[model samples]
Target: MSTHRPLRIVFAGTPEFAADHLAALLNSDHEVVAVYTQPDRKAGRGKKLQPSAVKQLALEHAIAVEQPEKLNTALAQQQLAEYRPDVMVVVAYGLLLPEPILTTPKYGCINVHGSLLPRWRGAAPIQRSIWAGDEASGVAVMQMEKGLDTGPVLHVERCAIDAQETSASLYKKLAQLGPRALVTTLDDIESYRERAEVQNHDAATYAKKLSKDEGKIDWSDATQLERNVRAFNPWPFAWFELPGGKPGQRTVKVHQASVSQTDHRSAPGTIIDCSPAGITVACSQGALTLHSLQLPGKKPLPVSDLLNGYATTFAIGVNLTNVD
Candidate 1:
């Protein structure tokens, strides 16, 4: 039993990360009056319409789910006002709220952002942090304003970035950390709001959304390539063109890699060594050891396992071309 006063929270989010926060609010002493999520999107091989993770969870709990195409319309704003929410919590909602909706709530809107304020303040923070070699990553609960993530932060939970941390792993870490922080802030909302700290706008850096084209591997610097391999894992995986193959058959996705210790004088992208351990490729600054890879239409496999059948394809002296 909590001693704090219960707040009528209107939850707005769309992805798995947002669903986690909604789950926390549901378990707490707060009353979730309504839920808002993105419209169903077509996905997978069948192209069938798929409900977002947040919507599915909201339905399972019997919460009223709202899926408006855009909140800028008058009817959408009226629907939100009917909830009479004490506060609105937004987490990766994917739609911008206009000023009227923001002011409708008694306590206004607060967002549970994926990164610390004044850094990585945009769509793809987790991926961008790992891609940029950031030492730490965390979550921030801030007051939402018209500007993009420029609001004053009420509470923050920080965590260190491990040497081998991938975007997928970091995303899970923050997903767990964020909900606890949100609940804690809501426990004493008035005090947290009064004590919110304004962010330093000059220090902020935007984390632009990712695209499939950004996954192409250049085989230049071994360290950067290794970081990219980790950052883009599980989606648009880091890839390169295979040497001596037709156009459609040349793309090979790299799943796992590490900086190599072996000395090599061969040109960049040249396969210097291949064994059951891994496939070693030479780069300008250093060498990289590819532990796992995926061929066209094939599942990702360790280099040792791939050697059983595609040994000639990845043979030593073959150059992995950097061309698209």
Candidate 2:
């Protein structure tokens, strides 16, 4: 692609979130000189080596793709110098950029972070936002520095967090919004108004990458909503233990849930009522209506499906609690 003043851009990203911005850049008027992505790693049950979404897109676009083990190496630095890019656009690149790589691009690097800066500043911003019940969250395009997501904001596009929004859904929204903000900011490069706010480290909290164990739903300790059954949907699914029978008693995973403030109360995790409407369970503060669930080795099915032939022999007022 030729232009009046072509920009030599180095693109760095890994996942689908980054891929969205990359697609925008490729279709833009600028020249993308090189693409940087994380090394291919084993994925799926077979553990076959799989390239990232960004890497796959780069291949289709016929752009030179680099999968370096680390960027700090002398070899990596030399390869980057060859491109001589004017600006580096980074989105969830996975690996941290040291001073050498950050300063290589003439205009420094710009990052597309999922959350509004000064809050949810670390990994897993999208998931954490829903868990915390934040009213709003969005994407931040920042001037990249050595500090972790502590760069000066170049532009931002805010979006409201719906009551029933999940990490998967919110991620798609932010991914698209990010590129729009990037394009707008680049359009008025000289006259763009930058809003750089210092993050309050005291008020800041980290959302560590989730583990499989985090999916286990502790009905006894968690409020109906705080358990966040929907937030954990499709990933680490919220699970609860069922009564033991013989060896290897099965457990149930609550795939979907509904929230309500009911005066009816019992021990947490106790099944208060079950009907065609839903399976109502007592919670720490209020009652939770379980709409969908899954048994071990079975697909997720609606509460009505489970009730048809696999009727739960849940007794009223039975205090049910799951222990590790």
Residue pairs with backbone atoms closer than 3 Å in model 2 (clashes):
none
TM-score of each: 0.96, 0.90
Residue 203, model 1: Cα distance from true site in angstroms: 0.7
Instruction: Single out the weakest 10-residue window by summed lDDT for candidate 1.
Output: 1-10
Per-residue lDDT for 1-324 in model 2, tens only?
112345678999999889999999888877888999999999999999999999999999999999898899888988998999988889999998989999988777888888888688888888888888888999988888888888777788999988778778888889889999876665554444334555566666676787767876666434535446756766787776666643345667777787755666577878788876777778776777788888777888898878886665555555457433
Error of 2 at 49 (Å): 1.1
Alpha-carbon RMSD of each model? 1.8, 3.1
Q: For residues 1-324, what per-residue lDDT tens digits would candidate 1 score against the true structure?
A: 333699999999999999999999999999998999999999999999999999999999999999999999999999898999999999999999999988999999999998988799999899889999999999999999999999999999999989999889999999999999999999999989888999999999999998988998877899998999999987788998886667988788999999998898999989999999999999998999999999988999999999999999889998887344
Q: After superposition, how far is residue 157 of candidate 1 from its true place, in Å?
A: 0.4
Per-model clash counts, in order, read: 0, 0
Off by over 4 Å in 2: 1-6, 193-203, 220-227, 245-251, 313-324
Q: In order, what lDDT does every prediction score?
A: 0.92, 0.79
User: Which pairs clash in the backbone of model 1?
Assistant: none
